[model samples]
Target: MSFFSKLFGGDKEAEKTALDLFKGLFGENAKKDDKPEDKPEETAQEDNTSAPADTGADTVSSGPSGDSWGDDMPAEDNQYRHEGAFWLYFEGIFDIEFAEYRYEKQVLTPFKRIVYTFYSGETKVLAVELMSERCSAYKFRNDCKKAGLAYTRFYIDHSGWWNTRSYVVRRMKEALN
Candidate 1:
């Protein structure tokens, strides 16, 4: 309700004394029934039923990305680790080995290096490694240029656990073609 309506409306209850407003703002209402959270905060008991089930391992769902990563890379590995959003979105286009991939902090401080090796009927055609994170676009461009690839794009892997940003492993073919 608008301020004017509340102040001058037909409802008598809406006409509040200055003291009522003060008490509400300060949370100093005399009666305990004023607030729904009258009692102390309820904490879960140590019993298994009360407590949440804890799985030791942290896992993300195989990524279900809206991003059609690419159609260039053919489906060689029939048995992909997991079928994720990539499969459902572009099911007939291509087969991608989509899975719940957890980023491992490597020898290089924070960035997790992901490598993709392409094959044509058991013969290896290309193998690319996405390295060098957190640098400038110039740096990435330079890296891509140096590697002879046309472009580089950031593919977000949202499995489930954590929303890891700045991890770029998108199939360069997707955006270009």
Candidate 2:
């Protein structure tokens, strides 16, 4: 469905001209010297420019950011599961924070289902997994259909995640007073 393949790459002269046409059509905001091929090659193993995610793959890796993980996670309408996005939404949108409780491995179930128990003091909010990827969070939040996960970078040992737990405790203490 994308004509981008035909438009860019190979024949540097043609690519430059095509890019210029696009720049003129889209906007004049782009700087004059900014040509993709003009830049020095990066030393990194991976290409710096993004290649589109392969839709054919069963689970396109969320990679460093937590978007999808195997069959355990729901693939559609799952944006609230990302660690940064989930926490940011609560804090930025509602000024609310939920205290998290992580279990010590294999204690909860035999299946490799990973999740956390969310709470406000003694009251439990819900049990869910934080997944990565961008999807319609609205469906999960408002609709009858259930979903977990959102576009964000998160892992069990991510230090920022542990720090975020403190936000809820502080909120709880403030509420008590």
Candidate 3:
């Protein structure tokens, strides 16, 4: 099962539930009744034709170098940048207190990593670790569970970032209220 399926539910079920939730939150137009078969199929010749060329003049680039969508950096380098961005995004959305806690692993050389814990007033509500890769997310989730904390891992990828942000914001609002 996918991480989302594990986090939410089964694939189709989670998608349907999310769709229903969005429809309810955004109103009726969010729900689509149209199916693919409703549209007329194009001939094989039409399918073979090349798609329209991009003019490129209207394209907006917002990445570090204004040439990509910000995923070109090495995963390790991007992790800290993504984590800071995630912090700013949440801080802007909600009125809450954030504390940074370090977990130190003892080896020949002690390894210390920072994790962000968010509080709704006096109650520690959520612990978040922003990871550059999906594998790290699973490890972080396990670590948080072992620590007996409410945890959510946000990945640096666009979809993962947005999905996690939405889920965390909803949960944080509920916890605060």
Alpha-carbon RMSD to native, per candidate: 22.4, 19.2, 19.1
Reference-based TM-score, model 1: 0.23
Q: Which ranges in model 1 have alpha carbons more than 4 Å from their true place?
A: 1-133, 155-172
Poorly placed runs, candidate 3 (over 4 Å)? 1-86, 96-114, 120-123, 158-166, 171-177
Model 1 lDDT tens row, 1-177: 756346557443333422333343344432444432331111111101222333332222244433222211112211111223212222222233322222121122122233344444564333333332222325544665676545432322211111111111234344233
TM-score of each: 0.23, 0.19, 0.33
Q: For residue 130, what is the lDDT in candidate 2?
A: 33
Candidate topping TM-score: 3
lDDT values, one for every candidate: 0.29, 0.30, 0.36
Candidate 1, overall lDDT?
Answer: 0.29
Greater lDDT among 1 and 2 belongs to 2
Q: Write the per-residue lDDT of candidate 3 for residues 1-177, one digit (tens) a residue.
A: 655467566766555545543443345432245332221211100011232332222222243331112212212212212222333544444344223322221121111122556655566556655443323335655766787767654443322122223344554444334
- Candidate 2 residue runs with Cα over 4 Å from true position: 1-111, 130-177
State the RMSD for candidate 3. Answer: 19.1
Measured on C-alpha atoms, candidate 2 has an lDDT of 0.30
What's the lDDT for residue 20 in model 3? Answer: 41
Query: In terms of TM-score, which candidate is stronger, 1 or 2?
Result: 1
Ranking by lDDT: 3, 2, 1
List the lowest-lDDT window of 10 residues for candidate 3: 39-48
